[model samples]
Target: MSLAFLADYANSDDDSSEHKDIIGGNNISRSEDSNGGQGYCSDKEDVGHGKGWWRGLVCLVIGQNSQLQELASACMDRLCTGTGGAQAAVKPRYVRVLGDLHISLTRPFYLQRHQLSEFARELESSVGGMGPIAVGFGGLSTYTNEQQTRGFVAVDVDHGKESIRRVLDRVNLVVKKFGKRRFYRSPRFHASLLAVKLAGDREMSEIWGSGLANEQERIAQLVAVRIDTVECMLGASKYSVALDRTD
Candidate 1:
């Protein structure tokens, strides 16, 4: 999503200002562990996208090395030879997570097993490590789809007790403006690196009650999305993305 869209998505355009640390205060105390223990931000503080507010915005992908950045873009361009052609190739958004973790952020949304194997090989042979790759199972009940993509909620919440409804509310709110087509018959929530698209019946059943695709329940799940970083750029490129964490 565009920064304009993101600012809106974060509901942070208000002129008011509020600052309260929830976990990591401006001190940004570091630890031997790279996860950087959660910092404090007053839930009441207006630290979203508002001007002058230190909402922990991350833009490392911008103004970095240009040559290595085109990695993903180059791949997409090559894949264009098959179907819609290269011009239609999907542009990848750059992002970096705090701490050294999985480095598989550039994989296509869905992937077949064989492709996943190839991706594993590529990662092992890659130049710089991206971080530990993130892997997950639930597709929703706690997520908002962004630009045909659904990512893990940045909201930080205890998963063992929180119901999935928490995440769904936020996700539904974010995607409400999208056309009906974006709503899948079975909207299973998953932030994919690579996978093949599934056939429709499109039933996405995670927790709660069954029959998701066609059933619209007032049910919702609150998800905690504690964002560590958010990188952005325009045009196409895979290598354009790089992951960096504060020391």
Candidate 2:
């Protein structure tokens, strides 16, 4: 489906903040807070056609765990060191650090300020009965944007695929009510580890062949995470729904 609604708003003069696309999803990015948080605030907070609308981005927060962080660091180091000449081709800025990892539940969309409460309420009610999900990383994979301008290195979801898909279905119902695009069809469900610009198949192959792809089995055994919260971030504010149900 066309995400022109989000694309137009993202490119509009009113909101010019940088976006970091989610892995296996569309051009969804999170705004950084001045206090070093992931909270995003718009430049024209009061200028949604004079209707108080904000670009709403939704996803599940995979908080920084020591194990995951170390895994990311080690993998990056290997990529930079093993790939001899190819390492020089990658810029440091495009690399995703500890705080940038997440699993997106829906593509970005527009939501008015007035609907914030109801949106949060509906989202909470939808998956409140679900307990925490224990997810493990499968293998290292590569993805590029639609324009093929950027490439990403990500770890696909191994265990807990069905549980995550259930959450995606529930979130999409709420997203449709607000007239936003649902999650990608046949989503791969992963946490982006690194992003590079202009890296085509040859370049990606060089990086993968450098030894990162071979480490997948070991990586899967090394990293397993417990996800307990799904967060809804609207412009500068954030709301979280905990997965604490016992039954």
Candidate 3:
């Protein structure tokens, strides 16, 4: 599936120093609060609870350097703006459109510290010799969740499909020990580009059916992405494990 439960990352001024500003040109204000008292917590507190954390494996696509990533982000802006309708006109909560536009490789799952460490070790051994994954943009599609409709720009990974399969196999082996389910049977690989709360669904539907449908092909072919490392998100932190560059 596509991603983004942590999109509005780094909301407070103190935490602002920990994050950088990128596409969409704004720092995501903390949806919670600085102290995290009844609000938000510092990074230390976020992970201290142990149970509140989960891990997600993903390949990075958008960041500070890519020209195409910049373009894709602009497209997101349009999709968000175009979704406004007769509803109360709430402002769209645009994700911080910078830093690693990614596609989830593993469903975010819970794991104890030792379990996560063992998984990391296994992952490192599995692909240390493999090179970068070649991927191409493949148009866009819409997905509906209980509260929102999200727009995903499909990604066509050259040799990475098989890698995704292999990785999932290993991941499922460990995750099952925790009684957690695995990845979607046939996960559509894509980068989540935009999200609109359900209130805007009617409007998003119209835009998707007409104006957007015609543009998918052109937009998808706009660029290619090469991913060289798999990143993991646990709690509020992110860490990377490199993939060897054989190509």
Top of the candidates by TM-score: 2
Q: Over 4 Å off in model 1, which ranges?
A: 1-196, 206-227, 237-247
Per-residue C-alpha lDDT of model 1 across residues 74-108, encoded as one tens digit per residue: 22233233222222222233221112111111211
What is each predicted model's overall lDDT from 0 to 1? 0.21, 0.58, 0.44
Give the alpha carbon lDDT tens digit for every residue of 13-58 in model 2: 1122344333221212233334322242123442232456666656
Per-residue lDDT value at 241 in model 1 = 19
Runs with alpha carbons beyond 4 Å of true place in candidate 2: 1-52, 82-88, 98-100, 199-210
TM-score of every candidate relative to the true structure: 0.18, 0.72, 0.62
lDDT of 3 by residue, 1-247 (tens): 1442222221111121233212121211111113332111112343334564444343442333355455546555555555422112325463334334556666545556655545555555554445566666655555444233333333334335775566556556655655766667776665654444435545444444443455555565565556766654444434455555432
**Residue 14, candidate 1: how far off, in angstroms?**
35
Give the top-scoring candidate (lDDT): 2
* Pairwise TM-score winner, candidates 1 and 3: 3
